[model samples]
Target: MAGVTAMTVQLNRMDRVSPWGFRLQGGRDFRMALSVKKVEPRSPADGQLHSGDAILAIDGYDASQMTHAQAQQMIRNSGNTLQLTVNKGLFQSLKPTGPIKFSPAAAYGYSHGHSTF
Candidate 1:
């Protein structure tokens, strides 16, 4: 932890509450996940898409009403080129790096691993 960068999220109560206080408004917004709390999936994506994807961008475009398809006809007529920036998987927790915690029996000389930021 010498000089690692950290990321954080700030939230407001209004974010959790419905805009109109209607029961239908909540489910219309997002999908819940362990890694990503309220993930946004593109419309015309009811049962196909899901949470936990990195979602860089869609076709180099933001998920706007025009870009995010609505009608089935729009989805069916989609272009073959799908440019996306996906995280691809869930975020995993890291283990602590304490001193001298190797189990020699299972060490096999290359026990530890490396990762780049």
Candidate 2:
């Protein structure tokens, strides 16, 4: 606490600071993590995934290690299109997209195919 003035903090979408904070300059860890879990049939998961399927990653970041609280915050912060690094039961991949697609003609939203990151 000596010689401390102010701290720049990064909060999750939920407005909570990481209870566990580690500061290692230029630190990086490549660990598989689960980030998002979209069980909506309108999502890429749809019938392809079941209720409990854990959607991992966003674009190329492993989200599995992230706790559920972390995951929720990231999802909300990502603005809809999330590029994740995912790993599931044996199928691993990246998906960048939104929950629903907007149709000009229909003036409504519909499910769109998951795009490759």
Candidate 3:
């Protein structure tokens, strides 16, 4: 993570429109669907997404075939009604077995008081 890990995540059409407030990160090869790195508070994705949850798609576009830009554009153009298919099992597997020792900030990919998102 040398440069800022950037990806545009937008929310579904609702009473309030806001950024989905989640960071999507993964290797560019698309061998696997991108994973949710963080979910911001009170955003549309906060309760529905979790860190490490594999994103299967946005709307009906398969995430397996998308580049970062394509994914971003798709979400931005989805008319405020983005639908996310998430794999919660993957997220559970990524969780620590013992009590969490790291700070919440660190867990969400914060480094040196700066957020990567």
TM-score of each: 0.25, 0.33, 0.58
| Candidate 1 C-alpha lDDT tens digits along 12-68 | 122322221100100111231112213333322222223433333344433322221
Among these predictions, the greatest TM-score belongs to 3
Give the residue spans of candidate 2 off by over 4 A. Answer: 1-38, 43-54, 88-117
The best-first sequence of candidates by TM-score reads 3, 2, 1
Would you list the clashing residue pairs of candidate 1?
54-87, 56-85
Residue-level lDDT tens digits of model 3 in 82-104: 67776663642233468766676
lDDT of 1 at 76: 29
Q: What is the alpha-carbon lDDT of model 3 when measured against the actual structure?
A: 0.59
Instruction: Return the lDDT, model 2, position 35.
Output: 21
Q: How good is model 1 by TM-score?
A: 0.25
Please identify which of the two predictions, 1 or 2, would achieve the higher lDDT against the true structure: 2
Q: What tens-digit string does per-residue lDDT give for candidate 2 at 1-117? A: 344232112222223221211110100122333322234434333334332223455344455465444554554456424443322333233444676465552464412212111
